[model samples]
Target chain A: MRPILLSGHTRALTQVKYSKDGDIIFSVSKDQIICAWYAANGERLGTYHGHQGALWTVDVDPTTTLLASGAADNTIRLWDVKTGKLLKTWDFGTAIKRVEFSPDGTQLLGVTERRQGHLSTIVVYDIVLDVEAEQADEHSLRIVCEDSKATVAGFSYGSKYIISGHEDGSVTQWDAKTGELLDSAQIQEDDMQITDLQWSSDRTYFITASKDKTAKLVAANDLRVLKTYVADTPLNSAAITPVKDYVILGGGQAAMDVTTTSARQGKFEARFYHKIFEEEIGRVRGHFGPLNYVAVDPQGKSYASGGEDGYVRLHHFDRGYFDFLYEVEREAEQANL
Target chain B: MSKVAGRTDWAEEEDEDSLALPPPQITKNKDGTETIVSYRIDENGKKVKTTRRIRKTVMKQVVNPRVAERKHWSKFGEEKGKPVGPQSDTTSIAENIVFRPSSNWKTNQSEEKNPIDKQKATLKDAKIKCRICSGEHWTSKCPFKDTMAPEGENAGAGAGTGAEEESAAPGLGPSNSSYVPPHLRGKSGVTGERMGGGKFGQERDDLATLRVTNVSEFAEEQDLRDMFTRFGHVTRVFLAKDRETGRAKGFAFVSYADRTDAARACEKMDGYGFHHLILRVEFAKKPTT
Candidate 1:
């Protein structure tokens, strides 16, 4: 179990996506560069320079060979994993806030950053199936409302629906096929922004992390409110286990002394995986910075995370305590992704 | 002696002079109390200012240790079922799994915790390198090469091996200096080194077509009609199924009955959105049967 150290891009890596087969990991940073690495060894593969601005999100098709990326540059670009070639670029005239590939790997979903007086909207597109074709008005679906601002954080089940976590702290479920509004609700009034969204393995429920330092579960079928788990610290990222029984949350202690606190040097007083039953399962408490992201593997056995302190740490539960495996300093700039 | 009345006048002048004298000084004593210290503001007139200092004692707040005791999931099983105890040394197994989306969590029973017993934690730590000769792995293809170099060797195995040697030493020195094959390396152990491969050792060819199923027998026709009309205007959908099973092949031979429809649908709906599903719309195969 040797942890591989990746050190090249110079800054924190904000976004990372695993290939369909989980063989490759693609990551991007605030440094405005994209890197592909062999998942197992953390070996640097190649870097793609497409977005002039920092990349916010990157998603690999769950079943296909296409890779979609959304960035601060206000354009979404399709890339071929084999050749690292850019296929097509679509301009939404606004910065892309989130990018995701549907469950079956057929469509690409992108959300826009906030605009003045107008709500954010999500764009759905059908990527040209043939690798050699070129046309802009191909298969496409666009869903936007005048007063609604939505950031589609992640997808659920087979991509039949999406849980859009808005900057306003609202979570809306949309029927992906019909572009109809399924159900919408807010955890609190413009107080908690859903930083991370994940679906249960069975597609039965989805969980969200709010700025209010709590993770709530939502029933997907009827959009019913489920249990809400509060963290001791402010929340930055959250993930649900593939088995659907647990969740992993990452963040740091809320600043107790606001006036004397340093924004850039926050500490992660606690990071842990909690059982959905409101039970604390395992925790890591040594990080002297805020946690940026937490990711569970496909099998739900072990999880990995990255923090503002430039460390990618792996944690595993031994009998009843979490044992730290390795912590690697990812020398890339990770900001919003 | 005769000027007794003049003496009274002189006495009045002396009283006015005494009014201009300074006040006395105040200071603290060794017993934590205050005292007056005498000082002079000028050589002739006695004037003073106090440098008195005061001290106050404060009591520290204390919390009941029992009330502060609370337990957490990360430290739950390791410590007693209280919050403010010594943090436990162990954690539940559910702590490490990656997260996914769920739909059944409304019920309190939806989430469960797996209890960790006396099982020893099997920490995963592996060097990403060759199993045979030690070398840097980013450029190696020899399945089994050493990650760390042995004493006295350059740790570099230069190119190419015979078929016999390659077969015998399935896990030998690294090969291929130019490209890194994506398919390799075992993740933590649940999935074998090739858990993602076909059930058997056979590799599926890149051009192999998938069989689609589940839609009505005319699913082929309906999809073709619906797509051509919406994709930008004309054509067809060919539903491909298995020959003997009569099941949808999980894929359809979609054709734009019109070439332009085919071209446009290819452009617009190639990756069309569906409920819980995203479809990869492509050109259908011609009916040869």
Candidate 2:
């Protein structure tokens, strides 16, 4: 077997995404650098260094020819994926958390947390038209994203909606097209803080991972809780696989400490390695450590994940199981024919 | 020679106001040459037309000596490595598209309505009706130029043109479902090690294991396994298949506890049959990922 070690980024890689064509993998580091590498050979293609702040997230267009990145300095930079040329940068004037390209690639949505006010804003830019219309005074539409007391952690599929989770233990979904409130749910019982939220592929369901040590799947149409799985540990991040099979939750030591104080006191180990969920037929295991970001391949055969450990692992789903605790006894003599 | 039409949702999406429709009927000369004849009809149905005749000529064919040399170089009188003549017989359709047709219609048309005649006929000499709205004014100053032709007129006028529609070709072959050329197909044999299934503890009752004497005997054993595994997923490259159940006979059963192990084994042992026997590989079951 050929083992490839992908170790180049100086610091923790916060985000990594396979190019739309699946030929290359783009990784962003907290070191403020974006690197592209061959997905098969792990050969480094090139590194883009322009962001002044930590590169928090990166996304590529469906054609894999364009790239967008969001930084903690509240700026979103666009780049040509093939040439690594900086096309333009949009400033949000606050700490930007997440940025995403629309499914059609014509629009860019940049979400930022407000430094002064309680509200966050989703800045929408018509990249194709505005880039050519670069004038002294051209006004672009900036919609007020679901304002939360905490950070706005997630956006929805196709760039059609935004779902914001807050420190106040509530989640709000907004209509991305018209900036209207679609639905809101009180995730925590007035005291629980939500950490992250994700939408299922069909856009009909969504799940939230919170400080309450539970991940809950709720109906998007009515905002009703469909089912809940209590990790009984502090959940750092949660992601539902695009195929709608399983919900993966990342548990950390802090979550373990909180769960240990409850009546069912169990020292929750950070289930860092991958695990298969029987309830979700194809629910594959995630990486080891509190996963910072998890993204599945478009083909759904494998997934790339990054964690707090500053490492990324590619998981290939197979039918057989591996017993981590079991050791195989080897008999060496007569079998060597 | 004729304008073809087609209908699709994207075609309808184009701005209709800017597009101009072609004339009803064009003319072809005695020598199989065709020409475009655009006309304007007055309110009384009298027509004033402008025509541009196109010229046609057949290109001469040539015989290529390089292809002939490749075919007959072994012959006694064949000239080897010599350049072929200009009149090479073999030519492809792609070479013909580059030839530009010369414009000689201006001088050849004596009584015919050529470009000069068409240009000379100004707005004052003839009361030309609008081609689209068929009003009293000529098309150059028609106000309805900004609007599409009436829907009923459009639907009825171009029904026959749909089948023969021609587009600027995106080059040869359909964009979808094209097969690779046969010559490019690999002739190389399966290389590397042979894929084998996992090992099972229990041996098969039907398989008869014989002592290997020479390389020829090993090759024959390998052939036997290849023939047997053809029936199902070959689990092991090491084991031969059972002739009766068409299954991996337990004697040669190489068990990969999982599909990943089996796939890895297959990749490693792809070409190498057994050392003496030619080996065939099969998956015990379908792969999971």
Candidate 3:
């Protein structure tokens, strides 16, 4: 497979996302610039440049009209994806760590960093979902994490529940409308923080990547861990593929200790694991530094990865990726036929 | 250096200016390729003519209407007012990687000697261009080696066995490591033997081996080993064969554990008749510079 390298970021990339149609890729970096690219050819669509501090997270709405990003500047900002205009900006007391839009694109959520006497919280706002409309200033619901800070949060299917992965290695399910905690499941060891949480195509189940060097798949409604994928290094991001029963994970040695270890020893690669078997299938190695995030296309034809080395690699899968099958999987297909 | 197309020496400046130049032209060939001929005057006031053949084909694909419209969206923010298409400063294609995920991908990476075999396969298909038409190749393969004087400074470079004396000349001593045309490296065949073929004594085996020629095409390594083992201990027997057909190419090499045994076999096999032809046997000579 030939990879297309996107080289617009001057600093390490923090996250990348594909549009609902899987055509455009939006990436944010610590360099304070957000870039949009055509996923098929690596062509730069445009750049969004208003954040004053390093960007921590970015998310595109399901309609592909509005883009949301959280930054260390103590605010979450929304931008018009087509014209690159800043539509709305929500101020917070603490820097926002992660931002995501609900499945129906009617609500947006932002996770705040815990610092300076402020307990971390997840806040939700009613989105107007139009480029020309005015967004409300007040948050519709705010869930305070009184025990341990939440690092990553997202909405469940039909907006029935809100699932958040926390700094204390627990996944918590909360009532989306009332902001009440329903259930909690400890997903990782040693109080390691969850770095990323991404939803599957249906949003009923999700994958969480943690600093404990493992990624886990959990049911959203009950907060029950289903499958666990153990990797060699601390994982920064995890993504579930749509059409294929596979998951892609990205991570390596932390950026601070990267100078002490070589790339080979750093384990700077995206590991692919079988969703049911929980066995590693293969790894794609390219980044000289740690891989920060990986996002699979909605159509499951390709994937994109952002790295600490300031590059986004877009890889289109070859025929072999779709052809590989385990003995049992092949027999199952034959039985179906 | 001497390969520059328009570098005329200062002494030939008058003669170069006395010639008239022709206009550039482009012609379309019947095979759907275009032939472009262009001329330009260089900094040295000499003219150069260049020829290029190029083929162009257009591909079409049906895409989603929204994606098709988004491709024409105007550049904004930092890319404001920039022209269409991917700017060179940002996007690029990286090297191709062979990614075939099998059930045993994790175990398959451990025992790979396949890359070296792939390189050897590529070497077999490498084109041999002549450099008198190409000196990057062997002089014997160049049709113009005996007829043409090499271009520019290399004109005085010898064309035959005199390549040895030319390489040892005093002028080339300092920058000899830079590049030397292949024809100037002599026909000693030393450079060719530097790589492998090590199963038999590519290194020191020549000290106790014999080269047998005029052997029948039907000759096998076992037959040669049987014939030569009568003298003493035969270490190895190698019969050069055609790759497609398993027949020998009329030659073989027999190695002995002792040099005296090799000498006795060479004497007995020299005038021996085998399969309607007399054999010529001699001590295998080692390559030397």
| Model 1 lDDT tens row, A154-259 | 5667777767887678888778877788888876447566777766656678777777888878887666768777766677777776633567787764434333
lDDT for each residue of candidate 2 in A175-266, tens digit (9 for 90 to 100): 76776778878876566767666556555667777778777776665668787766646765565554324455665545234434532233
Best by lDDT: 3
TM-score of chain B of 2: 0.16
True-vs-predicted CA distance for residue A289, candidate 1, Å: 3.2
- Preferred candidate (TM-score higher): 2 or 3: 3
Fnat values, one per model, are 0.00, 0.00, 0.77
Question: Which has the better lDDT: candidate 1, or candidate 3?
Answer: 3
How are the candidates ranked when ordered by lDDT, highest leading? 3, 1, 2
lDDT of 3 by residue, B129-169 (tens): 44343323564764445643333223223243233323333
CAPRI accuracy category, model 2:
incorrect
> Candidate 3 clashing pairs?
B130-B133, B130-B134, B131-B134, B131-B135
DockQ of candidate 2 (2 decimals)? 0.00
The segments of candidate 1 whose C-alpha lies over 4 angstroms from its true place after superposition are A1-5, A128-139, A253-270, A285-288, A314-337, B1-289
Minimum summed lDDT over a 10-residue window in model 1 chain B is located at B200-209
Judge candidate 1 at residue A82 and give its lDDT. 47
Best-performing candidate as measured by DockQ: 3
